[model samples]
Target: MPRRARKYAVRTTYATNAALALVLAGALTACTGSSGSDGGEDGKAGDSSASPTAAEPGKYRTLPKPCDVVSVGTLREMLPGAAAEDDGTAAPSAGASPYEGEPTATYDTDRRVGCRWKNATSLSTRHLNIDFERVVSYDPAVSDDEQAERLYAKKARKAGIPLDPDDTSPDADSEPDPGSEPDSGSKSSGSPKTDSSKKDGEKGSGHKGGTSPDGHTSPSGAPDASSSPEDDVTDSPSATPGEDLAPRSLDDLGDAAYIDDELHTADSGLHRDITLVFRTANVIATVEYEQWVTDKHRIPDSQELQERARELAAQLAEQFED
Candidate 1:
């Protein structure tokens, strides 16, 4: 019970109480942080909202140049005597020929591209246009290939070409036969003669048989029996002059392909328009070839136009692979 012993005891008790209070404060601060509160005891954790979503990536990150999609050799093949691209200048006209290749405008050099060529020969005039498109998908749920396929389907449908029109689709092949019509005059005015009719009556009926399917009537009621049957029977209906062009699917070109052909008759001559479209992976290519024949007496050949357009398509498609 001395004064010194009492003073020391009091100081030790105060120091112990202060140390216990500091430990309790430190434990509370850590608990608040681990509790997942917006503002921890330290108040240093700023806004803690969820992060923005990330975008999906496309298959092809780069596209080829549109102007150089086709080679100079192919361009020459498509348009004989056509000038080639020199540096940034177009080739000069040779002997007044119009078949020259020229690059078209491109809004985005990386995404879209186009080229054109034209020529006028003594026999006919030819023109060709090619376009290339690179597709990209911005959706997280869809892929680049899927997006390209969707666009391809839309283009194919817009072309109006029936898919697989050969055998399964009858609408393309089936047509009302112009020759199948029954002769009304023969049936109404003239009576059906018995097996043994008067020779004079038979001869007279044969001469008066009005008209054939082709509007050319013969002595016999039907087409000339001596002519080949194929001459009268057409495998497929031919395109009539001035008829709207219908799209037809083409095989062995690319993943998918089609062609649209239109025939026009003018005072100057007969002309034809042919369009070919093909898709490969993430790129879709289109080629447009138009022809004008100087001689109205001759009709423009469809096979020739189709073949040339297809060749251009194949050439353009090759660039996508690179």
Candidate 2:
């Protein structure tokens, strides 16, 4: 072969080899870069996987059957004079059974349940209502007890009952006595009439109906020595403080308990309402008992109704324990 031709071929071969080497190096760098970037991404994901994201579960998820929560014997004793249909008693017929209360309407039976009963007689009327609630925990950050506390606060507020149970009497400054305001006109009229009558008695005629100096018959006269003031006592209706009608806190009941008593006057008579609410764990139970009597001034025995309500509340709290 000619020398020049051989030299040119050798140069071309060298150039081709150098180009191939450069191409191979570039491909290797790209692979290394891709592998390194993938490794970095994988490392970031692995670090994040250590963090927890799941929430904690609640203790109670369901409530007891409202009607069955209270024993049958309790119902009979608590609701006196209740008719068969209203008391949950079944008829004597083949299918007839003792009274089992009717449940109230609710969006979800599992979360809440209630029952009511009522009966009326010619002399008096009676009614009973009960409710149950199941609490659930949805926050992973909060514990069941904490969630329950919050729920209890909400319920207490809605019921107008304080959490700590306000044992202290209402402040005089904050709440003015409703009966404190005086009637200026009544005072003025009463005093002048009394004074004038005394003056007239001292002056002349001792008769109670004697005319005053203005020639008007005296209506406010001193009573005769033979007559007693008992008639006045019998004729005037007295005003009472009605403290018995206030809601009071109870002790030795579940976590907390309260009783609210109200007196309602109607054409039938005076109705005494007693509402008892108790809490256990995450569940809250309420029982309302009411009765009407012919006596307008009669206040029902609170202890009796409280005992019955407490008995039922205890039974319901036991269900949570189970």
Candidate 3:
């Protein structure tokens, strides 16, 4: 009899409940070919002791010391009028040198990188409003997808979302109530009696329409519960109040992803690309960075670079906060 193959299976479900409720289902199967007496029906019995090892410590090491700095000063300088460039070009300043001062100083080529800013206005009324910082020992080899998954898992756990590795389907019953408030006067069928204006000499005087003796209408009558100020304090899915007001720090902002094919180049070795997107409220921002890779290096590790990109995104997100 032909040996049977060994199969591993995984099932996934994503339930979306909002204006609409949707349930997505998927399955993944990985099969191993049959093995023989020397190994079993498949290559060998699962080697519990032969678990795959992680990447060697610093196997793809980044520099301990800071590398050269690429001045974003030019980006800052051109930011003011960047919205007016009709040709979609990062037009170079009339008189500027590609190489000047120290590597720590920015090389202002008067050109924009992966993303563009439009209708950018700041409290200072400056043309360009985005700000950035320099980082050293940057590497880009890490998989941003993994990073994003980690972030999702972290957020899900924080929000009390069930995350049982043994169970793929989310606990549907655990979802919070997303319905509107019940009608306030549902239990009160009869209207309260209204009192007419009292005589001037009366000690207890009141007016119609539920006006109090002090002549102030009750809040419940003036502002219906549905239109109450509390209704306006609803939690917005897009706002991050703490993050917006907190002082900036160097902690990991999170993971981000970008496709290499999306990169554009102005000069032979100078390339720029937008790598990540951030949204706060209705405002969206795209972050791009410039790179100068050598001919010998086709692709550099970008994990650290992406980490920095996320930080920049967080900073940008802060701008839209109330």
* Candidate number that wins on TM-score, 1 or 3: 1
| Candidates ranked by TM-score | 2, 1, 3
For residue 84, give model 3's deviation from the true position in Å: 29
Poorest 10 consecutive residues by lDDT, candidate 2: 227-236
> TM-scores for all candidates?
0.53, 0.56, 0.22
The candidate scoring highest on TM-score is: 2
Model 1 global lDDT (CA atoms, 0 to 1): 0.50
**Tens-digit per-residue lDDT, 117-219, candidate 1:** 6544444555667766666655545455555555655555544456753423122112321212221111111111112122221110111112211122211
In model 1, the clashing pairs are 98-119, 99-118, 99-119
Give the Cα error of residue 232 in candidate 3, in Å: 48
Q: What C-alpha lDDT values do all the predictions have?
A: 0.50, 0.52, 0.25
Give the better candidate number (1 or 3) by lDDT: 1
- Per-candidate clashes, comma-separated: 3, 6, 13
- Model 3, residue 181: C-alpha shift (Å): 39
